[model samples]
Target: MAESQDELSYSLKREAEKKGFQPVGIARITKSKRIKLRTDALERWIEAGHHADMNWMKAPARIEAEKLLYGVKSVLVVGLNYFTIPENKKPNQLLIGRYAQGNDYHKVIEKRLKEIGKWLQTKRPDSKWKICVDSKPLLEKAWAEEAGLGWIGKNSNLINSKQGSWMVLGNLLSTEELIPDKPSESLCGKCQKCIEACPTKAIVEPFVIDSRKCIAYHNIENRNKDIPIEIQKAMGLWIAGCDICQEICPWNQQKIPISLDPDTQPKEWILDLTAKQAKEWDDKNWQKKLKGSSLKRIKPWMWRRNANYILKNNKFNSSK
Candidate 1:
């Protein structure tokens, strides 16, 4: 007997849970007025130079779903929780965001999405499909909200009631028509902790962020070694990515520390690195050190520059 759309959606959710994608939801594709408004807002933000050097945000991949996939009827939104609050900071240690501590999530999530796509193909052989991770320009958070995965929080992150904001999102677009889930509502209300917590004041408005002042943007996206004096000073000891906003969110407080997978924790040497080792660090050593890590996106010189900034800010000398 041919299974109903509800059955297929339930089956897909089961498989996604088996694959470790918690809070998965399916959304039907439609021409959205809200998306159009967001596109206009994005254009204005770009014009205001809020995007910094990431001009790719204006690319076709950022276009609407109907444009990205013809006859696209459904979007499978999946959330993977990568939230692990670090233990107390040790003396002279650099801070790396939890998201970048593991194998490149782009690789990990996309691999799983592909597996789900294959499963869908087996069930509906005639259906066309498209898979997207952070690498793709799709506005995944909006889709996630539409799919009832979570609400877009004041920190400009998708926040699930159960998972909080410590999530990485991936999407699967398919030609098959499936039942759509109800959209999650805005739960931010009057809370403004994330806004006040930012050292660089990157969150300009309730749900908007100016990347020019974002620590993560400067550390990861800024190709130039010469970061602005104010941003550098505000950067503190973050050598890779920043997590201040997410850390300050009330929702994230509920996150219990999960087991630390070997691949997901910073290398031992990284935690105990001294000024002497940092000064002697070179490109060859940097490549070998971050071989499987996502930090490789930034070149060796950038890493050195960030480390030097931190060392200089803290006035760390070679001794001890």
Candidate 2:
């Protein structure tokens, strides 16, 4: 006998949890007004140049699910909590974003999603599946909220009531019909802590961020160019990506009960890295340290650029 949609949804969630995904939920595919509004907001954000040099955001597939997969029926969204207790840093040590402190999440999440997709195939042989991580053009966070995994908070990071904003998202789109969960409602409620706490003031307004002013964007994505003088002055100890907004969020202040996956735990070598060392690393050193990590994308030159900014900022601050 064929399983009911609810039964299938429950099975899918269980399969995802067994593979270490938390807060798994399903979202029915539809041309809803909310989806339209999100697409429209994305267009406006791009028009205002808030996306900076990420030209891929203009892909039409981001706004039209049909472009990605024909006859898509449901989206299975999952969150992987990557939060681990941070290590104390020496004054000379440079900071990296928490997400990049571990092995590449793209590899970790994709491997898990493929396993879930294979499990679904056994249950629904006719179903077609497409997996998405951060590289995809899909508006993943919107789908995540529609799946009841979490709401997008003021800092524009997905905020789960239980897991906080430290979770990375993944989606498995399928042709098989499944029950959809209720969409999450935002709980930010007039709090402006993220906006106030931004060292570079990148969060221009609630739910809006200007990537041109984002330290993470400049450090991680802006290549072959010098960081702006004003942004350089505010760089602090960050040598890769910035997390000031998420760190200041009240949603992230509470302790997360679940232990982090071993693959997502901070590597000791990454913790021991200092800005001075990053600025001095040769190509061989860069290749060895960041071989399996997401921070490899920063490139040796980008690392030097970011480290230079941090060292200059420290000198200026100490001289004051």
Candidate 3:
């Protein structure tokens, strides 16, 4: 006998938990008003050029689940808490975003998702499943909210009331029908801490970030292009990606559960890197240190470029 939707949803959540994904929830595929609102917001964001040079965000598949996975009936969203409070910073240390401090979450989460896919195959041999991490063309954050994992905070990061905004999200689109969870309601209210805190004012409005002005975007995705003078001036010591907005969010300030996954822990080598080392690293050095790290997205030249900004800033500050 086939299991009911409620029974299947409960079993799926249990299975996901066993695979190390916490706060998992299911969202049935539907063209609901909330989904339409999210799609419209994404269309506007892209139309406004807020996605920067990431042309992939403009893919039609991003707005339509069936385009990527035909007959996809549900999305199982999961959040892996990657939050790790940094150790005291030593002088001259270059900062890498907390998410990239450990192993690449794309690899870690995709591996777990693949495991879940295999588990699902046993239950429904005829069902199709697609695993997606950050690289996929899916509206993962919106689906996460739809799944009740978290609401998109003012910083545009998914903020779980219990887990905070320090999670990396992954999705599993499957043909299996599952009972959907209620969507999360935004809790940001009128707080403007993230907006007031941004050095680049990247968050032009609440829950909307302009990637052209985002430090993380320039450092990680803007490849080979000269960072705008205004952005360069605000770069500070961030060599790979910036977290100023998340750092200032009250949701992130709350007592949050840190990830216990060994793969998500901060690497001492990454934590100890300095601007000097970054500027001096040869291609060989870059390949070795950044191996298996999400920071590898920042090319050797990009590293030098970002590091030079930090060095220049330090000199300017000291001279003052």
Candidate 4:
């Protein structure tokens, strides 16, 4: 590459790696046809009421990316592997989602993204930039695919060939032109394992999920005083975000365990929590243990609700 071309984004990948971001790529902004497909899909999803109570999905801000960052020339899409296989030897352990097993990813990702943004700003003194960690309305997975990080799996999670689907995505949009990498190919060939394995049949179709039937949505986003009986029964032992689809996917089976961060480990307390103890935990205790953890997003009452529901089923006390 020519010197002028190399200066387009000032070695964005190298700068991101310095801050411990991997699976990073730069993509030029344009009226991409792929983005149109994603927006159209979102419209259909919202119209079908699949978004459930997540009214934010219907907002215009989330419907378009150009409006979010007008005159945007490039997007620096990055992924951090947070996949850690748990050692749940006991049968009584409550199952919590792998993503929330550690500190809040929003905080971790944003901090790293800001550092990259600062470096890019120095390189392009006159350009504007924005750092996003799923906080904005932008289509993060779509951009990640366009940037060559990964392809959107049939289960709707981004699937990287090397890192699998166990990744947290973050982005840096800038008004500076940069060389864009070729988009990744669709690697999920005729795989229906994720769609077939869902307990609530949340994966209604390939690449589509109905939040109305999704346990993760009910447990995390649904603020209703009581969970619907059908959904609750289908929840089984999932006390937090559900990871059935990801776990079933063959892509996630092969993991570079030593490469991922150790902070992603689940707390010992979570592994040993029981329905009776979870119900007795006070507000002060809840805050103290889950102070910086993503699991704290669910209130103590909600925690008890999930635990009790699992206990009622007596299905299996298996924790993923």
Per-candidate RMSD vs. true structure?
2.0, 2.0, 1.9, 2.7
Judging by lDDT against the true structure, name the best candidate.
2
lDDT tens per residue, model 2, 1-320:
97887898899999999999988999998877777777888899999999999999999889887788899999999998888876777656778898888889999999999999999998899889999898888999999999999999889899998889998889999998899999999999999999999988899988899999999999999985697998898888888888899988998888775546898899887788777688788989998999889888888989988887887778533221
lDDT score, residue 112, model 2? Answer: 95
Tens-digit lDDT string for candidate 1 (78-128) = 987775546666677777777877777788788888999999988998888
* Per-residue error (Å), model 4, residue 287: 1.6
Q: Candidate 3 on 97-192: residue-level lDDT in tens?
A: 888888999999999999989988887889999998989999999999999998988888998988888889999999988899999999989999
Instruction: Write down the lDDT that model 1 would get.
Output: 0.81
Cand. 2 Cα-lDDT:
0.88
**C-alpha lDDT of candidate 3 relative to the true structure:** 0.87
Query: How many Å off is the CA of 46 in candidate 3?
Result: 1.2
TM-scores of all predicted structures: 0.93, 0.97, 0.96, 0.93
Candidate 4's C-alpha lDDT? 0.81
lDDT of 4 at 50: 95
Q: State each model's CA lDDT, in order.
A: 0.81, 0.88, 0.87, 0.81
Those runs of model 1 whose alpha carbons end farther than 4 Å from true positions after fitting are 255-279, 318-320
Q: What are the runs in model 3 whose C-alpha is more than 4 Å off?
A: 316-320
- Candidate 1, after superposition: displacement of residue 142 in Å? 0.9
